[model samples]
Target chain A: MNRTTELHPFSVPRYPSGNPAQRVIVQVLVTQDAGQQRHAQLLARADTELRHLALPQYADEAALGEALATLLSEARVGVHLELHGDEAFIWSLCGVARAAGLLGDEITLQCNESGRRMLFCVHCASLQAGTCADLQPCRQCGVMLEVRRHFSERLGAYLGVCADADQPYAQARP
Target chain B: MSALDARVGETRLITPVIREVSLMPVNGTLPAFSAGSHVQLHLPNGKRNAYSLLSDPGDTSHYRIAVRQQAQSRGGSRYVHEQLQTGDQLKISSPANLFPLHSTARLHVLIAAGIGITPFLAYCTELLRRGAAFELHYAYRAGLSDAYVEVLREQLGEHLHLYESSARRLDLGQLLGHRPLGTHVYACGPQSLLDALREQSLALGWPAARVHWEAFAAPEPGVPFVVELARSGRQVAVGAEQSLLEALESAGVELPNLCRGGVCGQCRTPYLKGDVEHRDLFLAHEERASSLMPCVSRGCGSPILLDI
Candidate 1:
């Protein structure tokens, strides 16, 4: 099926700039490359001072997770969270915020418009990132897969199932 | 609601005006309750009063409640303080929770004034058991109304913050301001204190869902009026000193109710016609057009036609 709004359940979301009801605005970016422009847009619309936290692309992810957890645990009642990054990166941080007790209304996710997306291979239970395609081979099990509209925020990936079960494996994608 | 037969197991003076009463079920084990749950006590003077259960929720053998003798006693408080004794048989309604803890709160901030500390007694115990982070802010007079200060301080250590109102007033604005994210604040106190907390929290842009409160005072007396039940076609005259719910009960018409203070939206009755004076903390503006809380609301001049 085509990537029409009605066909794709995992359509890109429209993020509001800022909420006036929030007393504090926190912008967390996984990478400063494409996220800087979105961060600037959020800052322009925010009435309150925006606290910016940038996670270096090559830094120790575990250490960054610990720091983000600490920061979220100390956040106050009227704080709003803005996340900017690719689906995998942003959803990972979103999970951390959720674990720290931030409700859905308090958080906004802005996924980068780049063609790269995370795809979860259902057959092999493997995760592959980079390039959105209708049909691709699972990196680990080499199964020809069809990208489905179903997306799991917890897994931070679109689901990929074996395409044309009659002909499985990489050979199926003649 | 089924009534539980209980007897006063113990009674002691918590303070000069406050009495801590323990009740044990006359029959089998009592039903378990959570923090912020309260039971309606059928008083000796034929008056029913709701009191917060202050004991640990895990304890099913007995329930504890503290009663502060109101100077303007409408008989319930006076009867409990003056005549109620140990071993006295009593009837209490099953526990109902009106001010439950916010389900996803990362940090719980509890604020209490005077006898309002009762519900938080159980909250603190439950929170501690869960190993959750919390702080209790209590404002009370040192001698007159500080019922649980010593025990709370000993149990909570630095987590308990006390403000003796007689010595200095509690700064509500500062207390509500600068709270960390995921913080849910619960307040139980007199109407004035509850009002101040609501105002301060709103000014700080705190979400209404994050701030919770339970007022301790019963419904204030309103102008006398008459109510006509639509279903039974019976008319009951409500006195100036009696609530509409009390009047209905007196006339043998019982409505399912909890927290007759009007915060719990249990007794929301549809009104066909009347000049309704809505005093409840629950209903929205649009809801007031179609329904009214008979527990605290009243009719002005005209007789109310209730769906009942």
Candidate 2:
């Protein structure tokens, strides 16, 4: 029996919600059509300052990444970051924020498109996003992987281990 | 904690109230300690006092600690100042870090008042070694409790900010306002300084975790009381001069403890009955209802029953 002791990102609300006491709150929209603009607007208050940055459609995330790095470097101690996008986009930026000295508590993720989860393959050390299925093939190494409930905030992905010990990796074609 | 026998290599009088002592291990090099580590020196007068390690943490060749002779010297600091000389043998507990540096902070702001600069001495070395961004705000009177001002000036250079007198007091409002994100502030000093730092940090919207402190305030003398062990049904009388932990130790009751000044939550004991005068900085107000830190906290008026 598999005990669901580890926390899945789904266990919390779509947007875990930014802290109201935060001195500055920056919400980044990875996709303009994620339909979280209304939800992001509701977070604004008189006391705390809230700013929004949107990623244009089909644009390179490199610019957004650069902007985020600059913003985080200049940000003060009481700043909180909110990311509104798909699981992959949110977690990817979470990595960027963590690299820039932002803690897990300082960042809130609101996955506009849920049900699909990001998994980190242990065999190949690659990340893949797929349906919320227990078993999925590793996209990089072609190994059958089992998604574990263990979530890594640093990696921003669920742990994926080899589903079958006998066949660690898929057979190569002739 | 097991004691390590050490010989006093050197001693220097920093001020009328402060004495700096260096201890060399009798057998081998001492264990390496971190930034905010301290050790309990079992005094010649049978009293133990915890002093922060001031020397470089990585250098275990010898351990240096500064002792501030308290006005009400329980014979611990008094013995060190009056009798303890070079070549004297002493037993000191291994270094324990109750106060530690925040691992992931982008910028570290250290605020020290008087002899409280001891821990930050190690912190400055460690932070510089890591090549991390940091600033040290030291509030001390010139030639009074200013132990290593010259050395710190050479070391910190631009990062060190000193407040010499009441005329140039530390501005908490300006100090805590508008810092880069992922900044962590550490304050070590008297209770009043720590209290003000907490209040100002909270008012400035700083998270509780972002603001750390180590209070050097030792337990004040309190009213005498008796501690009744629940299991053994043995009663131990504590005197006004002795701390509850010291009394318990004298009674041969083995209790795990560190930082006996009451910041470390190692000696937290569940109580079944009696009112307690909680003097510890560790426990919350609600937790004080069921448990008490015996290191500094004490039983009041009635016989306190301990879960043991």
Candidate 3:
């Protein structure tokens, strides 16, 4: 339906607009209470052919991982993905999408939580999730981490290393 | 870093279509670089092209690159193949790496198609020196193309596998199956190859962190659009093959630019109007609300109004 012309998959102004695919497969991932209403709304927007996969409201980081794996394996390539949830949940979805090799241009990441986000580590790089306050906790072999920036494109998690070693605590500060 | 003078040391025909061009800096030694580093050469036609360094990054004696002559000679490759000679002095940008190897991957899986094997040449060197666990799987048309097969086989030995013609179809499911927890895959080849690898890696549940790729060619040249300069009120037509940055330059308008490929953020310009198709990775998502990287980004509906 010439959908590509109106909204470039990964481009900004993502929707100047286009027609929804007939029998289009839309995946709606719901994670938090605040995102439930939007999740329902997104479901209404999709056609009956839309494939649905839902994570429990209290789904933790691991559940998000499993959900993403299902999405990558089950979601038809070139189909649209609608992520309805909090920043952490959204990041989790993004991390999974990335691991499954979905490019930012390939899917739509709709974050329900607009507030500043704090990412949960999968503990893949280091099994340490988000318990520490500083970017660097003398815990990981003298390595300092910058909590907010340097997101891993593939993992969808923010890379927690101090981007600049000289200024180790930049993320901790305002 | 600014460009320095280099002479074409030696050039050889690596394959039916690929030419190996060796470059040596006129002054002292060239700067040391990492495995996936590439250097840009300024051609006499005023066009610049970046090529991955195929020589050992440790020995800066001279840098080597494999250039494949495309159906469309953008003048850059043609200049190197046709006019450039052993004694010809050329200006080359310092080596820069947008595709650096990950320092933490436990097991590395390298995949390539045709000339996509260029960057991995240097990577094999460093990986071997560090005694890293790695394997390279290559695919090519049976008799059509295979750039550095001999060299890779000799160095990689049993570690390298080549799939010719009908078997060239990569079974990514099997390749990415049961990957160790920290295994990482790097693919540089045709967009189709990268897409397949990425899809299978993701489907098999590989962490996005470990699926690395570098495009064999530049980003797709987008649809034709227009740019209206606010200062002079001049209109410039940007062709599909041309970027906003090039169109403005052709119109005698100049903006700061470094790696014309959009790695360097120097060409960003404030925009006053029109929907921008931001194609670059340089600017943050929010930054695009007010500005754009002219080198890669373009206008969608109407002519983009630039503050320039």
Candidate 4:
């Protein structure tokens, strides 16, 4: 498909001149349900602790981690958290939080696994594994999670590696 | 409505009831109707089924419709074709038209596949009555499967073009090229045929508003999303897997809906906020900004707040 023609309003643009190291910031707003309240509490607690943690300059790992913790903690109440950050950091933090038992069992993770790029559902607690399927409200709980991304100038460093991964495609003649 | 009452006021079996029977009735007292008009037949079991009127509008008392027995269908078509005799009565409603004739064009182009030919047959009838310029491209899997072929051939003569897809595929692009300027195109068929026609028309720069469609059945709904009733402050979670209308209906929200496939536009509601993933075939893209067909479209990532 032609990228230009298939472009939707939410699609990210190709940054030709931008630095590869920069990361994007995403904001996720999670609504709480009975099964998700615990996850929210965990996230709130992690956010409080991580806000004071010292991390690399231009890298908001501390904030990102806190967001993950908040999301994971809410998993128990069926509350889903949205995370916005560089793709890599979001995946890593989510993985860590899930491993830490902050994220619960009902939540399913769907991802490309190889590409590590896709949308995540807080309700299902699952990453979209391959192509995005139809948007669905959570069946287990009624809460909906909204995901939005904001590219921050300060978070640019973390994006450098992934941005370079696609460099070879730019060199190919169209 | 008596079980013995003929659904159609007038009846004429134009063709003998072969393996599959077809009927052309003279609809007495039935009001004049446009293309895509259908009449509801009340069955003995108290259920109703709608069949498109296929006869010419000029001929009063004669409304044409063809029926094929489906082994799995709820027995509407089978009863009409197999059980109901020519003189038998069927309880039918007055002619109602959800698919109206397009008035914005000098030339009308019609494409019909299989049983989809019913509406176009009526359209051609109206066009012939008005002496309007129009072209009909009818495609069928087999020449024998083309119901009413003899009638169309005798009536339309050179104006009708029939193609057998079993021999070759219908070339929509070629047909589009020969279409007259300011022509309005109407198509009905299986999703694949309709999809192909839509894609080719869009690629050829046909105005989105100029293309009309009516799907036989509503396609399955995509993933669900959350719907927040703004006035009632009732938040309901709907899966992309099921239609919001269906979900709401199951939840006991009484929303008026007809032809749930998105043609009637009766299920439209105000969108208070949030993104809507539109899938309905009724309104043009511009109409989507304010209202949505809750029957088909799903909400995007966020919770769609609706006035209803």
Candidate 1 per-residue C-alpha lDDT over A26-100 given as tens digits, one digit per residue, 9 for 90 to 100:
444444344566567667864555666666643654666677788778766666777766666666677888888
Give TM-score, chain B, model 2: 0.96
Better of 2 and 4 by TM-score: 2
Model 3 lDDT per residue over B1-308, tens place: 47879999889886777889999989998988889888878776656677899899889889999898776664667777788888888899888887788876667889888888888999999999999999998887754577777777888998898887686666888887755434678988877887788677655545465678877544346789888889889899988766777777677777766567665677789989899988876799888888998877888996788887
Q: Give the TM-score of candidate 2.
A: 0.89
Off by over 4 Å in 1: A1-22, A25-47, A53-78, A111-174, B44-46, B102-106, B176-182, B202-205
Q: Could you tell me which residue pairs clash in candidate 3?
A: A10-A105, A95-A156, A99-B208, A100-B202, A135-A145, A146-A161, A154-B208, A154-B209, A155-B209
Number of clashes in model 2?
2
lDDT of 3 at B198: 69
**What lDDT tens digits, residue by residue, belong to model 2 across residues B159-228?**
9998997658899889998887778999999889998998888777776778889988477788889989
Candidate 3 chain A, poorest ten consecutive residues by summed lDDT: A11-20
TM-score of each: 0.82, 0.89, 0.60, 0.46
lDDT of 4 by residue, A1-174 (tens): 223214442343232211211111111332111224433544464322211111232245556466556544443212222333333434454455445342222122222212333444433444432222222232333333232232222221111111122432224545
lDDT per residue, candidate 3, A1-174, as tens digits?
Answer: 124324433422132122223233344444444455655666685343344455653356577678667756654333445555544555566667656644454445555334334433322255333432434442444345555433443444444554466655344645
Decreasing lDDT order of the candidates: 2, 1, 3, 4
User: Tens digit of lDDT per residue, candidate 2, span A28-89?
Assistant: 33343444555466455655665555666335667777778887777766677777776667
Candidate 3: stretches off by over 4 Å: A1-174, B219-228, B231-242, B247-259, B262-266, B274-291, B297-302
Each model's fraction of native contacts: 0.58, 0.54, 0.00, 0.00
Which stretch of 10 consecutive residues in model 3 chain B shows the poorest summed lDDT?
B201-210
Candidate 4 residues lying further than 4 Å off, grouped into runs, are: A1-174, B1-28, B178-180, B218-262, B267-308
Give the worst 10-residue stretch by lDDT in candidate 1 chain A. Answer: A12-21
